[model samples]
Target: MSDASALRKVMAPTGVLRATINVGNPVLAGLDVEHQPFGVSVDLATLIAHRLEVELELQVVASAGEAVDVVSREEADMGFFALDPRRGESIEFTAPYVFIEGCYLVREDSPITAQEEVDRLGQRIVVGKGSAYDLYLSRTIEQAELVRAPTSPKVVAFFREHQLDIAAGVKQQLEVGIEEFGGMRLLPGHFMTIQQAMGVPKGRSPEAAAFLSAFIEEVKAQGEVARLLEKHGIKGASVAPSA
Candidate 1:
């Protein structure tokens, strides 16, 4: 089959490219005033669909884990996610198109004043279950316990409700949480930098995965990624360097 034909067959088998939009990652996606998904991820999905000559269908979900599930199960053609080894089991990710920070937030009166201080006994770090940070912390944290919030947007609320020692997630999200919840302060500096990429379910045509990687590099080189970040008013995240 021709390259175009193969790409279409693998990426839009149903004649529409279904892209999973994880609205829980506010830095990449969120609902607008009308509750329609709109953000950098949404725009990139549109671009990919247009390039494939197919209709675009956004499968919006409330959390990163749900997004991963939809894409991994092939219910969606593609998704945006942070680079994590556990998730790579079923998803083939492009080099990151964006980079975001994973940070820690704590109550002002709490004694956890430094990033290193978080990984101590009796400190419970609240994270969105199945999120990239959750997966990372699960594998790396040896002492502190993890309390899972239902979603990233709820991490702060979960932390507050449980009086957890730390709330962990996107720095931008944590900043918003501090404003909404009050009495919380982010530990100076972030713990990890999340590499955000577009990915397809494994077993799709290799040509399709190659196309996604090329698309990411092209957008980054052309400044389309930067434009999207600015257009969405996203702060504290930068376009990933070309792969």
Candidate 2:
């Protein structure tokens, strides 16, 4: 069988390229006025379907964990999310196509003026549950207290309600939501850069994963990724280096 045919079989077995879209990560995906998924992830999912010559089916979910779960269970063909050691165990990630800065936000009057300052014992940090920042900080943070929010869009709200020391999330997410939070300013430096990639469930055909990875590189080289980011007015997310 042709390589194209095999990829189609492995990636779109139901005759549709089913892609999980996470609207919880507002920088990547969000619900519009009518609450429909719209953002960078949606465009990438459509591109994958067009490349495969199949119907595009978006499986919209509220969180990255939900999106990854769909892919792991084979309920969706693939998903777009961050690449982390824990998630990599169950999914095969392609070359990252976007770099999102993860940073901490503190009240304007707060003494913490830098990223590293938040790591001290007794300081409280709130992060979205199951988010890339949450997973990373959970493992590496040894002194600071950690808290959870339902999603990235709500991290700031959680921080304010609990009167926490800092809130961690995608830089753009905090920027967009912080105006409602009076006197809140982002720390001068970021804690980490979330490497965002397209991935398929582990144990799927490697041929399909290879095709998707090559597609990411082609789009990055051809400027499609940059165009998409600009079109969405997405800031703080730089195009990632080719893998």
Candidate 3:
């Protein structure tokens, strides 16, 4: 086949690439999953599929842990989750695409107003099971009793229902919960720095990796990255070159 024909074949929309979405946060990278079919991570994945001439098939899953296993086991093509160094060995990360800091959610009238104050003795903190916040809390806040909820909303609910003293999550999520559930407050200080990235199964086809790299670069070059961030009202996030 001619190079042009080969390119056409590769870029043709074969079908939607199977994708998984975490049910927790709707707005990521300024793209509200509710408004736009694509969030920051989904947009990144869609761009990759489009460039490769394939369609994107998004699948919503319950937790990041499930997303990780689905992609690693080759059940799905890719996953948009907070990429960490430890998971790097099991999956291929495109690059550090975005950054979000961790924060605490508490009752609006509660005494916990700041992250430092949350560290005081007898404070109980809740976080989603197997999430970045859980890992951070495990390492840093030794004094507070840690309760693990299955999902982000549940973490907030655990605190709201008085099952726990505090809940930990991203700023956007904490804000949304404070509004949705009522009587919740987002703490001032963040838990730690977090970086989001795209991942696929280890040893997946070279075609997929090449497509991911090119798609990420294309979005950055086209300024879609910045636009998505502002569109979603998600601040403190920047789309960087893929590593």
Candidate 4:
């Protein structure tokens, strides 16, 4: 088969490119005034579908975990996600197209003023269950206990509700939460820099994966990624360097 034919067969087996959009990650996606999914991820998915010459079907979900699950199970053909070693087991990720910061938010009265203080004994950090930060902290946190909120957008509220010591997630997300909830401050710097990328199920043909990898690099080099970020009014995230 020709390369184009192979790409379509593997990337859109159902004759439509179903892309999973995680609205929970406000930095990458969210519901607009009309409650429709719109953001950088949405734009990328649309572009991918156009390139594939297939109809675009967005499978919008409430959380990143849900997005990852659908793609890993082949329920969706592709997804955007924060690159994590744990998630890489089931998904083949292209080099990141964007880099976002993972930060810690704490109560104003709390003694913790630095990111380094967060991992100490007796500190309780609340994170969205199955989120990128949760997965990263789960593997790295040595002493502090992690409390899980139902979703990333709820992490700060859950932390306040439970009186946890800290809330952890995307810097933009935590900043928005602080404005809504009040009485919280982020640590001086980020704990981790999240690498956001496009992914397909590991079971897909290698040609499909290579196509996506090349697609990402092309978009980044051509400034489409930066343009999307600007169009969406996104802040605190940067286009990743070329792979």
Candidate 5:
């Protein structure tokens, strides 16, 4: 079979390429009033479908964990996510197409004035389960007790309800938390920098992964990623380097 035919067969076995999008990650995507997915991930999925000559379908989920579940079950052909080693176990990621900062948000009057101050003993840090920062903290946090919220947005509520010492998440998410909850302040430096990328289920044909990887590089090279970020008025996300 021709490479194009093989690509279509593997990427769209159902005749529709369902791309799972996590709108909770504001740096990558968002939902409209109608709850339709929008932003960079939407644009990328649309372009992928156009490139493959396949019908496009979106599996919109409330959080990244839900999107991860869709890909883990191989229910969706592809999804967008931050490149984390933990998620890589069941997902094959293309080179990252964008970068966003992960940081801590503390109450304005809290004693954790710096990022360094967060890991001290007795510090109670709340993070969303399965988020990029959650993965990072899972590996690095030793002394402080890490609290897990059901989702990223809920982390702030967890922090407030329990009076947790800190909340860790994407920088934009914490910024939104401040607007909604007040008394929240973001640390000056990033705990980590998340590399957002496209991913497919593990165990797919190597050639299939290669095709999507090359497509990602091509899109980044052609400046479509930059155009989308600017068009969306997204200030926190920057196009990732071509790999």
Candidate 6:
């Protein structure tokens, strides 16, 4: 092997560097153009694979719950999705890469237009099972009667079909839903901030952690991550260093 290849192998961990991220538009922060999954998270994973000179596998789970399962079961070497502190004990996070805000989506004709409306009177808030918004509603809006969808797309469809009074999703996700389906509007405020991170399986090898940290640092320092985010018109996101 070439010296560079040899050095890479030395730094690389044994086995495949598999990764799974959502396939949704704006999959990473707000970086979806042409309704594609060209988000910053996708760019970071692809870049890491290139630098490590290792195979990169990308998997798309239908929902966030499945993404969590991918890492927990060792089916994926890493998972890139929104972070929940409750999940930290089950997996190791490589520092947050992006931050997201959650909001409620409603039909344009719906009476729920503002955050206060959601707090006081919102009735049916559709959300995916195990999604951040589902958890948030369960805590904050006890009377809201949260409806569960199996995937983000189904959540959007629930609202469009008038089966739900509202759907909760990230700001960008709601935007994508509106553009794709053409009849929804965002409620006036946010429920909470969602931090996005790369997660390694619990008790992962040290070499795996080293490679992820190094890959993230290089992507941040070289501006590759930023460039990809910009290419997709994502604004207001910055890479957080791995802790």
Model 2's lDDT to the true fold? 0.89
Give the lowest summed-lDDT range of ten residues in model 4.
Answer: 1-10
Backbone clash pairs for candidate 2 read none
lDDT tens digits, residues 174-221, model 1? 999888868989899999999999999997888779999999999999
TM for every model, in the order presented, reads: 0.98, 0.96, 0.81, 0.98, 0.97, 0.80
lDDT of 3 by residue, 106-153 (tens): 777787667778887788888888786776677778677888887765
Better of 3 and 5 by TM-score: 5
TM-score between model 5 and native: 0.97
What does candidate 2's lDDT look like per residue over 1-243, in tens digits?
987778899989899999999988877888899988899889988888998899998999888888888899989999998989999888999989999999989998999887778899999999998889999999989999999988777898889889999999999888876777678999887889999999998989897789889999999999999999999989778999777
lDDT tens per residue, model 5, 64-126: 888888998999989998888889999999999999999898888887788888898988999
- Score candidate 2 by TM-score against the native: 0.96
Note the Cα lDDT for every prediction shown: 0.93, 0.89, 0.70, 0.94, 0.88, 0.70
In model 2, the number of clashes is: 0
**What TM value does model 1 have?**
0.98
Off by over 4 Å in 4: none
Better of 5 and 6 by TM-score: 5
Greater lDDT among 3 and 4 belongs to 4
55, model 5: CA deviation in Å?
0.7
**Model 5: residues >4 Å from true position, as ranges?**
none
